[model samples]
Target: MKRRKNIKTVIYHGSIWIIGLLMIYPIFWTIASSLKPENEIFRNSASLIPSIFKWENYAQGWQGFGGLSFSTFFLNSGFVTTMVVIGTLFSSALVAFGFARVKFRFRTPLFVCMIITLMLPSQVTLIPQYILFHNLGWVNTYMPLIVPAFIGGTPFFIFLMIQFIRGIPHELDEAAYMDGCSTFGIFWRVILPLTTPALATVAIFSFYWTWDDFMTPLIYLNDTKLYTVALGLQMFSDPSSVSAWGPMFAMSVASILPQLLIFMFFQKYLVEGITAGGVKG
Candidate 1:
């Protein structure tokens, strides 16, 4: 029996390592490819390591393909993504607090409706939303991409936070009230402090989502000056000729570095937040 148990544990551990490698291989390949020379990119017998590293690809990609600079795109992406993360975190936390703590008429129904929004595909609403923004004179601006975030654009984040908030014991609120705390005071002093882990999770998720968002920025930003990294990557393509593989790979590598750093820095909080939320309500 002990031998069978040991065999099962070994098999499980081996399977997990294989899955981890499968997931990590693409990111490893992208970084490795970014360093390869253009001539070696598609070579039939090329190894993972480049014979000569092409660090100049990053510089070239930063300059621009032909007309526009990627530095401007990076700035635009950073600004928009930062705004989206801030908006999503603040708005979702506030809305989730209301659902989790406050008693009100039709609260359950409203929460259900909010969750229903998550089920609708963005493609279905794309045309109407575009026309609305066009009529509002926001079609070619960052407003369209960043404004909805302030109004609880993501229902899933709100729901995740609500679940986490619900897991906190009601006794804490009652104790705060006994100490002469108002509802707002209890929320500010008690609930928010205890929810740091969940908020970190939401912030990280929002940052990544907005940073990688391509479709919305493509539709809303018209001027070359206003392009995000995702949109700017398209500049590497030459409709009349071959694309620049080295620069494109370099840009892709650079674009993901911020998100990777953020995850690494806040990884502990993210795990605690997720696990704490999983506690029975």
Candidate 2:
């Protein structure tokens, strides 16, 4: 029995290491490729380690194609993502509280409808939404990207929060009521405090989604000044002109750093949040 257990453990550990390597290989390749010169990028006989390191790619990428600097793109992405995360978290949390705690005649049906929205692909509504934004003269602005989030635009976040909130005991609400707490008071004081883990999960997910969103930004933002990292990366590519592989790779690396830092900092809360939600019910 002891030998069998040891063998199983070793197999499991080996499997985990293999999976980790599989996941990390792409990132390693990207970093390695970023160090390689343009001439060596697609070389048939090129080594994994570049014969020479070109650190200047990062600087060139920052400066961007022609006069456009990546600093502007970074600022745009940061501002839009920050607003979207904040808006989504606050809106989704408030709506989830209503769905979880408040009673209404059409509550279940309304939630069902919201879930149905999740089933509908964004592509189906993209043209209509674009037209609406254009009619409102929001085509060239960040408003189209950031404003919808405030209006409970993320049904998935609401659903996730609702599930988490549902797992909280009704006894807690009753206890708070006995202490003279109103509905809003209970939510703000009791529920919100207890739901921090779930909230953190929502916030992190929202941040990552909004930060990486490319299509919406591309469609809405026309001015060069309003470009995000996603669109700015495209400036590195041209069909008529040769693309700069080195600078583009450096820029890509730079774009990923902030998200990496955020995940590293908040990853602990994600596990805690999921575990708490699981056990609470």
Candidate 3:
């Protein structure tokens, strides 16, 4: 029996390792290709080892085009991502608190409407949103990309926060109210502090989404100097000409570092937040 159990454990772990490697193969390939000479990139794409490690790919990629370095794109991405994350957390938390705690007229209907938006595909609203932004003279600017986040653009984040907030005990709110805390005070002093794990989860997700967003940036940003890393990476490809595969792969690897670090640091909080949100008090 023990031998059978040990065999099962080995099989389970072996399967998991195989799956993990398969999932990460692309990333390994990208990294390996980044260091390889351009001629060898596609020629020996299946191999993890490179014949010649061309360290200059990083430098070439960083040099960028039209007098703008890749640093500009990184900075632009950093700024936009930072603002979006802040806006998402602030707006989602405030809106979630209202729906989760404060009782007001039409509140249920409004919550229902908000929930309905979650089911609507973003592409359905894309054209209308673009026209609206265009009319508002927000076309070709970061406004279109960044403003919606501050206005609670992501219904999913609000929904996540609402679920997490609902799991908190009402007695805590009552205790805070007894201490002369107003509604906002209860949220600020009590609810917010206790929702740390959820907030971390939200922040990490917000960072990831905003950083990786390509379509929105592609639609709004036309100036090369104002491009984000996503757009910057796109510049490396030319359908009519030879593409800079090595530099593109190098930049791609660099682009993933921030997300990898974020997940590594906040993975615990992310798991706790997700599990906690599903449970009720």
Which candidate's TM-score is highest?
3
For model 1, residues 1-100, the per-residue Cα lDDT tens digits are 9999999999999999999988997887788778888888888323578888889988877777556788888899999988998898889888998999
- What residue pairs are clashing in model 2? none
For candidate 3, list the clashing residue pairs, or say none.
none
Model 1 spans > 4 angstroms off: 1-19, 238-243, 268-281
Ranking by TM-score: 3, 2, 1
Greater-TM-score candidate between 2 and 3: 3
Task: Please write out the lDDT profile of model 3 over residues 109-162, one tens digit for every residue.
Answer: 999999899889999999999999999999888899889999999988898899
Tens digits of lDDT, candidate 2, 1-281: 99999999999999999999888877776776677888887784334587689888888779976687998889989999889888988898899999999998899999889989967899998999999999999999999999989988878778778888998999999999999999999999988898887888888878888888888988999888888888887766554543678777788888888888988899986666556545652
**How well does each candidate superpose onto the true structure, as a TM-score?**
0.87, 0.88, 0.93
RMSD of 3: 2.0
Q: Local distance difference test, per candidate?
A: 0.84, 0.84, 0.88
Better candidate number, 2 or 3, judged by lDDT: 3
* Worst 10-residue lDDT window, candidate 3: 235-244
